[model samples]
Target: MMYTEENKKEVILFGYGKFGRHMYHHLSQGGHHVKLATMVESNYEEASADRIKDIKRFNPKHNDSIRMLGINPAKHLLYCAMEHTSNNLFLVLSLRELYHDAMIVAISNSEENTRKLKYAGADTVIDIYEASAQHLVTNLTKPAVAEAISTIFFEKNNLKIAEILLESDTLLEGKHAAEIDFYGRGLILVAVIDREMGDELIYLSRGVDHKFDAGDTLVLAGKADDILSFKMELAGV
Candidate 1:
């Protein structure tokens, strides 16, 4: 996608730790304006100050400290990727309290913390162990598919992995997965989270044919435009 100043999102990333740094780099490379915030002075000093527009110190306990950062909740995407689960939870809670409608994405180290983070008002919670394990499993079982996913996400590509929920009115609801021509539509159907199978993700790489149903989520990798077009076509929009 061609990024212009008006189209680019402003990203506010808290904590300059490992995960924070990774997100900063990823967001920056994706053409979004990224600002790094950390509680530790050393982390602030270690960050790439030249590339980032602003680096500020924020205190999780102080609401005013966050306000001082001048984050516009509606326009900015906030990331709480601190190394400690406590800090992430507190950051999410504090941010939610300050900006009730802010979009906050937090990282959790465990399933228990994932639930806590969601309850703490995080808009999205990424489970670190679950994500890492999924990647490991994919690499072990299907190296080629793993590489494709990595290239789409990590490389300079407009392709992205998105979960498209099948609503009741979708045209594909009653069709078999193999009957739909995803590749012809410029999309790769990676897996399907079958609602009938207790939301179990059945990987399509194994050549399994699944009957599409409402409430099932299709995991697809493709360009943003193609994905949007596919959804629109499926919904007959």
Candidate 2:
């Protein structure tokens, strides 16, 4: 997907480990401005030339070094996916302290660390193991649902998963999910993650008419171009 300057989001990724690398690949492929930051020297040598060019080395222990990156607290989306839980926790803490309003997403290895990361000021904490286990269980018990997700996310290269952030006074705010013509825009409303609902994903496939609100994340699935066009239209750009 090609994002115009008006709508492109800046993504700053800390660590170049498995999860970090995966995030970089997808975000870059989607045409977002992504910067990969790492403290380990070997990670630079291991990363590809394209990624290495954008990689910035910084000392994770120092607040000054992190601030040197010049991250825009209001605009840049930060991801802390260091291989070690302690590193991720420290990074999240430092980032929260530096940019109190910034959105920090961290990956945790266990439920215990998920709580720690959240307490450390991460806005979103993704438990990798828990997510994996859930996917495994879903595949085993809900084969049809699993197959459908796999087909949309993995099997179809043209399809993309988009997280549309709703802002105050936006066009869709206060509207019901059923009232929107998503299919006309060539998109599917997969789910809605509302902040008021403790960030729980309310799947639309259940036929629930969810009322839109600011801070709600609409998860949509569709062709990349169609998704981007619809996003621009929603933003009135």
Best by lDDT: 1
TM-scores for all candidates: the values are 0.68, 0.74
lDDT of 2 by residue, 181-235 (tens): 9999999888999889886899987878999999999998888889888877878
- In candidate 2, where is summed lDDT lowest over 10 consecutive residues? 1-10
Off by over 4 Å in 2: 1-8, 48-51, 154-156, 161-237
Model 1 CA deviation exceeding 4 Å by range = 1-7, 48-53, 158-237
User: For candidate 1, lDDT tens digit of each residue in 124-191?
Assistant: 99998899999999999999999987878766667777778889978898999889999898999989
Candidate 1 TM-score versus the reference: 0.68
Local distance difference test, per candidate? Answer: 0.86, 0.85
Q: Give the top-scoring candidate (TM-score).
A: 2
Q: How many residue pairs clash in each candidate?
A: 0, 0
For all predictions, the C-alpha RMSD in Å is 5.3, 4.0
